[model samples]
Target: MTQQKAVLRSDGFTFKQFFVAHDRCAMKVGTDGVLLGAWAPVADAKRVLDIGTGSGLIALMLAQRTGESVAVDAVELDEQAAVQAQENAAASPWASRISVYRDDIRHWTQRCEHRYSLIVSNPPYFTPGSDCATPARASARSTTDLTHDMLLNCAESLITEDGYFCVVLPTTAGDRLLTLALQHGWHLRFRTDIADNDRRPPNRVLLALSPHPGEEFLDRMTIRGPDQRYSEAHCSLTRDFYLFR
Candidate 1:
């Protein structure tokens, strides 16, 4: 089935991203990407890799926050999304520092020789039996496109010994992924659980893992407070990327 396309305008953050057009992918630029981008670690990273780059949102965010000191590379499996990502990168202030490739993460890792200080992915996390309204959506949300094992393997191969691997996934799959990481000898460094509001259970887990880690640091972030307004923690976490604090 043919995928439907959409054009997304920038939210006027530092990155000022504009997704010209995209199809054949389930996910688009949304709150998840923004939250992940703003929350990912970027303090001392010299080189970064973004897997399943999609609209290149995370790459742009890293570029905006890191300046030209850090080089960012993005990998996308979908041809259309890759093209759009390149365009978005070119349009950004850090165009010279960002590069987008139309390749799968598994293939990219096999050919990658340079090691990254940080790797981030807002990957496909929906498990089986979840509702998928369309083929494109299924491809966007399912692990079939890029399995957890594939991501972990790439992380092990592409990241340096001291580098960090970070991702945001559904809470259900997050624990399982952490288990898989432990099995692969990777250590969880930091974690944050997210909920829509104070009343709801955490639906997403944001994690940062590394090879040189002692003990995992776990935290929680509630997106909204009891008033149904943005929580102070959430606002602070996203203040750098969002137009309004």
Candidate 2:
């Protein structure tokens, strides 16, 4: 299959089953969010949580992948982004299965009694002092508002005994999360190093962690091949959700 290059639209991103309108979101639809949405372990996830669900992209993706029995909750802190997320989910085919909450995950977790079987986040990984174009973008990208420690603690409190907490982060930041997860008694279940091309060192990593210890799976994925086309492995992983794959 010839892979059609994906264009990043300012208004929204159109997937195979739904459209994500991200005009009001600080963070627009990007490869990291899409990658985490499509690749996270969702086989038996009865209840899923998407933290910082800008435009509700990952939540909607999970809703599309899971059975009708599943329910997905999306939490966002930013008002505009949260509203956009809610609108996006409401417009999707899986509207009934997805719920959008406009609150900080830490606050939401305190009031919520539900435990999730699967939780995924394309979290704020940039260093706190890094400069961004806008305050909203800064909040979305940097750890000042939602630090790694806070995220791990929130996930730890909300996850069931056998639940999986997955995230996509830049390789350096991912390593920090890995260390923190281990320190917090979470075990690594899977890891995927991703690079723009095989010749380049990985710039991003997909990590799946669990409360129970298990054999860890590690692999590498290159988004583009030598000819600069989408690699077969990347295409295979995302084929279900990408319209032009």
Displacement of residue 162 (Cα, Å) in model 1 is 0.6
Error of 2 at 74 (Å): 0.3
Query: Residue by residue across 179-211, what tens digits does model 1's lDDT show?
Result: 999999999888999999978899999989998
lDDT (10s digit) by residue, model 2, range 116-147: 99999999998888999999999999999999
After superposition, the stretches of candidate 1 with alpha carbons farther than 4 Å from their true spots are 1-25, 128-131
TM-score, per-candidate, Cα-based:
0.89, 0.97
Off by over 4 Å in 2: 1-8
The per-residue C-alpha lDDT of model 1 at residue 29 equals 68
